[model samples]
Target: MQGILTQITALLGVTVGAALIAKFLRQPIIVAYIFAGIVAGPLFLNLVHGEREIFHIFSQLGVILLLFMIGLSLNFNYLRRIGKVAVAGGLAQVIFTGVIGMGILRAMGFAFMPALYLAVAITFSSTIIITKLLSDKKDTDSLYGRHTVGLMLVQDLVAVLLMVFLTAQGGSMTISSSLIRLALGGLVFIVGVTLLARYILPPILRRIADSKEFLFLFAIAWCFALAYAASRFGFSIEIGAVAAGLALGSSTYQPEISARITPLRDFFLIIFFVILGAEMSLAAASTVFLPSVILSLFILIGNPLILYVVYRLMKFSRRNSLMIGLTAAQVSEFGFVLLFIGRELGYVGESEIASFTMVALATIFVSSYLITHNGKIAGAVQNFLAKFSEENHPQREEKPPVYDAWVIGYHRIGWNIVQVLKEKKRSFAVIDFDPTVIEHLTKEGVPAYFLDVSDVGLLSELPLDRARLVISTIPDIQDQVTLLKHVRLHSAHTVIVANAPEAKFMRTLYEAGADYVMTPHLLGGKWIGHMISDGKASRAAFRKLKKEQQEEIRSGMPVQEL
Candidate 1:
């Protein structure tokens, strides 16, 4: 105990120093910890030496806590909202990338199993990194951000199933029987957790709610207890942790539990990253180094392009689709976990695992900057796309001399703005990328064009600068930034109302010369607060609101069939 504690103390000092340097350099804190581990590792200063087992356990705890938090945050309604896009678009991305990645690995002299495992593993982007970056940017509610989150949820489910298969792999029973036993065990465990959470747990929770200390202890105990139970039933401890959190999700105490657990989770997570960094020592081998670089390049570049094509086929605009794609340009924590499991199962080696570690490190570092500067990156890409559109895209010979008002990316928030324009009997036109939206709007006698709003060359042909007003309901940062700049450049006096999904980018749009910037997430919350303050939270008010919102949902859809 004394020796391990001493090691931890040294590690703490080393980590703090690295974290400070990372902050000073404006780099990711995760990258810092990885480097800190390398510096302090037995391979270097040997600051941490005895019983690596303890650190390994702590790293697993970090993973469990992270997964549990994700389980707690799972929302069925959100999954339902973006279900098709998340499942279909996400699968398409994997299919394309998997095939390409498999070919790359196989050609690089990898065994079939290792190649397949690496291919599948690398297809999943890091939800942890993407979510944290998006949350920090206050963009978790943005259109592209929302799609990215939904896709992460889909990937999470797939990861869980993969873990299930891995868990069954080590059993004495045959694969089919092991799977059957595992499924039955899972079913029983879920039922028991459900019953307890619904009935027995709440009463226990109510008593603990008043004591912060007790609540925190209870949550940890409950989580570990579920984990132990799952392990006894031949399920992985990670799955149990996730199931426990999901069981508690309906409880009112979730917020308190999450708030209490987050700091602890983060601490353990640092240990996880440090251990991963120590493992990076293996990646320095000359044989693996070249292959790692090649795979990292594909993850950073090809992954986004593949996902962008998928989203484009799903009818998302170029700017929004590209923004979403950029969020997924790195390999996932699950990829690391899979490589670790494969090593344990003798399907892979330390060199293979190290190759993936290097890939994760490279892609995460590059993709962090990609996501951070998405607005500028997408803006630059849009410029190239615009030139291509001008050179090749078919254009209407005749164009309207002027539109009284123009609505860009007409859906969601645009629907309400369009309704108001119609009520005022103003001449307006809608621009959307979705052909069905254009068809529906045309059938309704609205002048809607199915075109990319970011196509500056195409937009130049349309007299958008002559419009009295321009409103963009596209809740994507890059889209709003590009549109705002283009409109301001052409006609400084136009009343350009743009949408931002968050306050930070709301300011960005305003600075880019938008006359008015709307952030629906912010505005909607403030509106609700005012309503509640004004005594509008009554049953009658809710009843009226329910009807109006239902009607709005029907009216706001891009197409009735969709």
Candidate 2:
């Protein structure tokens, strides 16, 4: 017991030291954790030697918890909203990358099964890493960020399915027979869970939610119970854990449950990454260095190229395509998990595992910087990439009719403004970079232009000078700056309203010649204050307001403005 405690202490100490160094170097803490693992493993200090099994158990728990949290946050409606590009594009990239990756590995003298496993492993991009980086860069709500997230979610679902398929193959039955049995079992489990979630879980959750402690405990219990059941049925505990969370996902307590599990998840995940690192054999890795480097290059370059072609064919702008493609240039955490499974299944050896691990480490390390500085990278190569775009330039062959109002960005806030404009019978044009948004508006017979306000050339094409009012719902400071500069330069008298999420940016926008800068957070607070001051803050009134908002949503009208 003393020895185990000492190992834990040493592991934590090493992790902290490595994390501090990684932070100083401006690298991801994940890189630090893996380094710590290598240091603690037999390759170095050998701190985890006797307690390796314990650490492995902790790592598996981490993965199970992580999948549960993922299921809790998975919103099917969100996937639907992102539309075909995310779904179709995600699947297309995976299939193409897998095929090409397998071919590359085969040519390099790998057998079929190992190459197949490696290929599938490389096809996924790290959701956790990308989400963290996107949040850090404050691009979580950006068009490109949304698309990237949507694509990752789709990939995640595919990974889960693949994991289940692989688990099925682990049995003595033939491939087809195993698959058939698993499918039938999966169908029964899903149906049973869905029925329970819809009818049984909600009421129980609501009752338990009254006591936070009980709710939290029940969530953990449910997760482990389903996980155990899944393992019994020959599926992985990861799938079962995710299924449990999915069952509870529609409950009112999902957010609270997720919050309660996150700290636990983070704590265990450190162990998981460490175990992953500790398992790597540097000697074995050395044998496959050349092939690993080749695969790494393919992931870092070829994966992005595939996405670029996919996005361009979907009519996305060169800049957006570049950003999205660059974001996907790394293999995912699930890739590591997949490789680990392959090792366990005897489909790959230690050298192959080491090869893929090196590829993941290399691609993740480089892609972090690539995604964070994607704007600069895209700007530098914008000219060169523009040549490959379906639209070489943002072109409106015929001049759009002059309008009373021009709405830049057709998302949440802009959508509300469009409703107001329609009600007032104002002539307007919606400007958005997202092809999906533009297509939707065009289909609705709304005057919409597929133009990014950030592009000075695209801004020039729009008749902003003639519009009496120009409102930009885009919260990006650079894009807003570009719009304000153009409007101020060309139409000094036009009223320019801009949106800024942070109050700190309000003064900047105002100074940049914005007549009014709307801070959504502040606006929401002011609205609540108004309700209180007007004696409309009663519970009944609040419920009535909610009802009205829901009705508006149901009727396809925008609710209150952000």
Candidate 3:
């Protein structure tokens, strides 16, 4: 017992110290955790030698919470809106990668079943890493970010179903019976969450949430209950935790809950990654180093190429397609989970698991480097990759209509401005890359196309000179700067309105040549203040306008009450 406690203390001290150092160095913390793991694992100090099970349990919890947040981010309607390009691109990448990975594994002399498992493992992209990187780079609001995230959401949702199917295959049930059982399990899960969310949790949470301590305890209880329920039903605990988050996400309390739990998630996740590293068998890994490196390179190169090919075929501009493709170069954390489970199922031995882990480490490390140096990489390959583009298609010829205004991002703020533009008889059109938003606009007879403004080639295609006014509702300061620079080069006198969520970003946009910047909260207040000062009885009119606008806002939001 004393030894165990000592190990825990040493492990935390080293990891926390390393994490602080990494933070100061402006590097990814995952690298620090892995390094700390190597220092503390069997290969070195051996502080965390035998207590591997505890960390494993915590890691499972991380997976659950991660999946739950993923579910919350998903909007089923987005699939309907993506054009032939995104859908074709995503499907093509999945199929091509899965097949190629399997072939490579088989050629290297692995049996068919393990090869299949490895292939499926390689098909996943790390949603967490991608989200964190995109958010950090302030690229999350770009057209490529939106399209990439939507495609990832589909992959995750499909992965959940695949997990369900795989779990059943490993059970005692026959395939047909297992399918029936899986359907029943999902139905039960949905019903149970609805009952708990609609009837049981809200009132209790309301009272508990009034006290910070109680709210924290209740959240833990909620997470544990769902996890236990999932285990009892022959499902993964990760699936249950995700359901818990999804239920909470459906509530008005979601943002608050997410905020409160983020620190806890961060703390636990460090231990999880450390444990993952500590379990590695260096001697075993070395034997398979050649195979692992070979497979990792395939993932680093082939995966992104598949995405790029599909995007280009779908008619996306070179820049946007490239950006989206870059996000797929790494194997996901889910690949690690799948590899671990492969061991438990007796499909892979310790050496094979070590090989997969090495691949994870290599690809993740290299992918991070690639994403960080994306500008340099893009520039280097820009000319060579252009040869693959189907740029001569007939659809490129039709000229965009002459408009007085052009709006970027048609989801949140853009939607509201579009309504106003219509009311005022302003000749305006919107630029967006999301399939769903574009589809909705098309259905409403608005001139919308799947556009990626980050793509310099696509920007070159737009008739920006004809539009006297431009409004960019995207939140990325860098992308806004790029667009502003191009627009200035094309037409120096065009009036431009853009948005930023923060003062620093707003200032950056203004310096980049924005005529006016819309900080949503500040602008909303100013608009209401003007309405209140308009005339006698303006307060009453303002109240009515608020109700109508609020209703419209709620209706147009991507999130729906589930």
Candidate 4:
């Protein structure tokens, strides 16, 4: 116990020191944690030599909890909203990366099993890391950011499947029999959980939620219970934990559960990463330095290339394709876990693990900067990369049309604006990239064109100079800036209304020549406040408003759906 306490204290001290330095350097704390592990491992001060097993156990729990939180956020409805690109593009990137990576490893003289494991490792990009970067850059709602998140969720599902398959292979039964049993068991588990979530868990959670202490305790207990059941059924704890979270994913309490679990996950994950660093052999890594560099280069370049081709073929604009592609150019934290599992199973040796670890460190560190400065990076190479597109053309041509107003991005907020415009009987044009939206609007006799507003050349061709008003519902600052600049330059009298997700950007947009900037949060608060302060003062008026909202829902005319 004394030794364990000492180890924990030492680990925390080292982590804090490394984290502070990393923050100062503007580098990811993940890199610092791994580096701390290396400094404290057997190759250095050997601080964790006596408590390696404890660290290992903690790390395993970290993986389980991390995956559980990921599962909690994986909403089916949200996935459906992102459309087919997330699923199709995600799977395609995985297959291409794995197959091509395997070929590369095989050519480098690795045995088939080792090559396969390494290939699988390279195919995943870190959801936690990339999502953090995207969120920090305030681009999570941007076209590429949304798709990147959607793709990562799909990748998470695939990672779970791969983990299950690898676990089955390590079992005593014949590979085929084990796989069959695993599949059946997984199906049964999912069905049972789904039923419980739909019928049993809701009532139970509602009661627990009334007591904050019980709610937290029960959630942890439920996670472990599912994990134990999975172990009994010959599945891994990681899979079971994720399944547990997935069961609660549709629950109203999911966000609270996720919020409570994150700090715990972060605490344990530090141990996991530290152990990972401790286990790596610098000597072995040095021997494979050339190969690791080759693999790292492949991931940094090839992964993006694969996604770029996929996005281009799917008819996404060149800019969207390039940005989304850049987001995938790193190995995921799951890659490390997969390699660790392979080492435990004896499918890969220390050398192979070391090589992959080096690749992870290199790619993750570099990709952070790449994603942070993506705007400049894209601009620098946009012309060169445009060659990959099916056509090196500006956004589609627009026939000259006279309009009093132009709406860019005909979704969500724009939908409501379109209704108002129609009610006023105004001559307006709607520009959106979604073919379905365009086709529907056109069928309804609304003049709609398929165009991305971010394309300056294409946007310039639109007769913004003739319109009295131009409204942009697109929340990305870059796109808003482009529209504001073009409209200000070409049509000084046009009133430009723009939307921003956060208040901080409102001033920036306004300073960039926007006539008015709408911050949704502020507007939402005001709307709710008006209901309470005014509507609630008159019961009849409140009831009338409620009835209208209910009727709208009944008519399937919800603002979001539109």
Model 1 root-mean-square deviation: 14.9
- Candidate 2 error regions (>4 Å): 82-87, 106-117, 126-171, 232-235, 315-320, 332-351, 371-383, 390-562
Clash pairs for candidate 1: none
Candidate 1 local lDDT, 1-562, one digit each (tens): 9999998888888899999998999987777887888888867878767769999899888877866765565444554677888999877887898999999999999999899889989999987677657755756646787788778767766776677678678656566776687778878987898798789987787666656788889989888898889888866676677678777775555656766787888899889878766655553567788999999999988988898778876777777778888889999878878988887888888777778877887887788889888978988898776653332322122223477999987777777778889999998998875545655587788887654555564465467788889999886778767777888888977899988877878778889888888888789899999999998989999999989878877766554422
Candidate 4 TM-score versus the reference: 0.62
Per-residue alpha-carbon lDDT of candidate 4 for residues 146-170, written as tens digits (9 for 90 to 100): 7887788679768866766777777
lDDT of model 3 at position 345: 85
All models: lDDT?
Answer: 0.78, 0.80, 0.72, 0.79
Query: Candidate 2, clashing residue pairs?
Result: 126-332
Per-residue C-alpha lDDT of model 3 across residues 387-418, encoded as one tens digit per residue: 75644532222233788999998866888788
**What does candidate 1 score on TM?**
0.62
lDDT of 2 by residue, 417-479 (tens): 998898888899898755456556877889877545666755664689988999998879988
Query: Against the hidden true structure, what lDDT does model 4 obtain?
Result: 0.79
In angstroms, the error of model 4 at 64 is 2.7
Tell me the deviation in Å of residue 124 in model 3. 2.7
